[model samples]
Structure formats: structure tokens, C-alpha cells
Target: MDVSKPPFGDDDAHLRETTVSSQTVYQGHFLQLKRDEIALPDGGRAAREYVIHPGAVMIVAVLPDGRLVMERQYRYPVRQTMIEFPAGKLDAGEGGLACAQRELHEETGYRARRWARAGVMHPVIGYATEVIEIWFADELTLEQRHLDEGEFLDVFAASQDQLEAWMQAGQLTDAKTIVGMMWLQRWRAGHCQFDWQTVD
Candidate 1:
């Protein structure tokens, strides 16, 4: 259905908000909080606050047996251990595919010989300007993992059926991982296709 293309049409002029003024409220290592005064479509002024994040990449790595490589880690903000696809934020000036490759190898010790970019997702559209680029990887070879300092996660493999079961049983709650599963299912069902690239 070509969901990436949005029909902005003439309604955009009526719904768009123009930035009047913007200022940084807080700046972290890679995240920045900004508050902006915006001009509403109805000629009203309002303030909008949001977080600016360095975009990230999520990898849906698959084994030869079709099991998906996954991770379990504790998220401090949510105070819960979450299962997710291997993902990481982009370093300054880093490309999406590079980040995906690095993250998959670092976290899961798997280097993919074939890769395909699926699409991008905005996980937190309301309060954060964070976009995650999704990639699918196969022909994986296990290697030594080099997790970043203080980063801790357990890497495991699960079949698509297991993932679906978890989702239905309220266990798989990671939005990005769920989206990856959807893409995987659609691709497997021939509803969509990926332009696979062989990586050295």
C-alpha cells in the first residue's frame, strides 16, 4: 500500500504548526530536550516540548533454521526487562546500516552475510523525535560479542511462532520488535519483498 508516502494534500496547510521560537531545555550525552513556541493553524500560539534523539537502527537477525536473534535487557526508565531485536543508536554521522551491523555483532555476536533494509519507524512520535531504521539480516555467523561498557543483555534465538505466542500471551511488548516480526511475516508470506544485499 506504499504506507511511507503520506498524502499531505491541501489539508497540511490547515493542520501544520509553524515554529515561532525554539530553545534547548536540556542536553544529555546524545539526547536533547527542546521547547518551542509554535503558531497554530488557527492563528493561535502554543508551546511544544519534545526530545531530540540520535536515530537508531534495529536488526531482525535470522538463523539458518529461521529462528530470530533477540535480546533481553532491563530498561531503567521502565524498570522492567524487555525483549527486543538487537538495536543501537547511531553514532555521530553514522549511517543506518553501519549501526545495524555493529549492533548485531556487538550484542549478539552474529555477523550477517546478507542484509535488507525494511523501513523506518517512529516509536515515540508524541514526545520524542526518535526514528528507528529497521533491517533484516540472515546468513549469520556467530562471532565474539563485544558489548559496550556497562551494557548488559542476553542474546537468544526464537522461532517466529514463539514470538507470536509471546505477543498473544502479553510477553512480547517491544514495539520495534513486534514491527520487525510483522515485516518478517509479510516478507515470508510473499506480501512484500526485500532487496537483499550480500555483505562482505
Candidate 2:
């Protein structure tokens, strides 16, 4: 399938909403909330509130032994420790590949010789303007981690079978990690192809 084009052409016009007015409700160091008045397709007016984010990248790094690099960290919003792929927000003016590489190294201390962009996913389309760009990394070499200040996490490795079992047991619930696992499985099954590149 050609991913460059939208699945439906002009048929989606009826579902489109035009922004009448927009206001910033709140602004933080990383996220901005916006409230907008939109003109509905049915000639009605409505308000929409959503977050404006800088976007992020999630890395699915594989060790030489086939174990996937993972992390366990406390998420304040959910009040629970979560298992997730190495991920981080994009710094100003950073490209997707650059963000992926930096995030993997900073969070897990693993740099990859070969990398491929799997796909992008919108985890919260209902409220947030955030999208996670997924990248698959292999040929990893361990280095020193440079975690951000106040960031606390435990970096570990797990196999695909273990991840699948965790998901079945409701132990792995991070959406991006789950999606990354699906991409890995699909690639392994030869359902898709990745144009992998080597980087220094």
C-alpha cells in the first residue's frame, strides 16, 4: 500500500472541521494546551481542547542475543511503574532519526550501527496532538547512559516471547511498546520491509 496518500480521497470533506478561533489555555516546558472554536461540517459550532506537543520517538533496539532493550520507570500520571521502549521527545529542530538515536543512547546507552524507521503511531488522537515515530535499531554497542535530570529508570533486555507473554498477562501496557513489538513481528514474518541504513 502507498502510505503517502490518504486512504480516502475527497470523501472525508464532510468530516472536516474548520477552526474559527484558537487560544492557548496553558503552556508548560514541554506541552501546550489549546482551546479552539471550530465550525462543524454540519454548520454547527463546537469547542475542542487538545494538547500541542513537540512529538517523540520510540526505539526498538535489539541486542546481539536477540533481546530487546527496554525500560521500567515510574509514570507519575498513572501512579505506576511502566515498561516501555527507549523513547524521548524531539528537541527543537531535531529530525526524527536524530531524535531516535539520541533517545536510544541517552535513555539506554545503546548505539546502533543499523537503523530503520518502522512507522508512526498516534496514541491519543482524541485529545493530544502527539505522535510517536517508531524506529528499529540493531547492531547495538553499550555505552554510558546520560539520562536527563530527575529521570529515573531501569534499563533491561527482554525477548519477544517474553514481551508477548507479558502483554497477554496485562503486564505490558505501554501503547508504543506494543506497537513496536507488532512492527518487529511483522518484519520478522516478512510482511513488510525496512530500508535499513548504517550510521556512525
The TM-score, computed over Cα atoms with residue i paired to residue i, of candidate 1 is 0.96
**Local error of candidate 1 at 3, Å?**
8.3
lDDT of 2 by residue, 73-179 (tens): 99999999999999999999999999999999999889999999999999999999998999999999999999999999999999999999999999999999999
> Which candidate number would show the highest lDDT if scored against the true structure?
2
Number of clashing pairs, model 1? 0
Provide the lDDT at 158 for model 2: 96
Write out the backbone clash pairs for model 1.
none
Per-structure clash totals for the candidates: 0, 0
Candidate models: Cα lDDT each: 0.94, 0.95
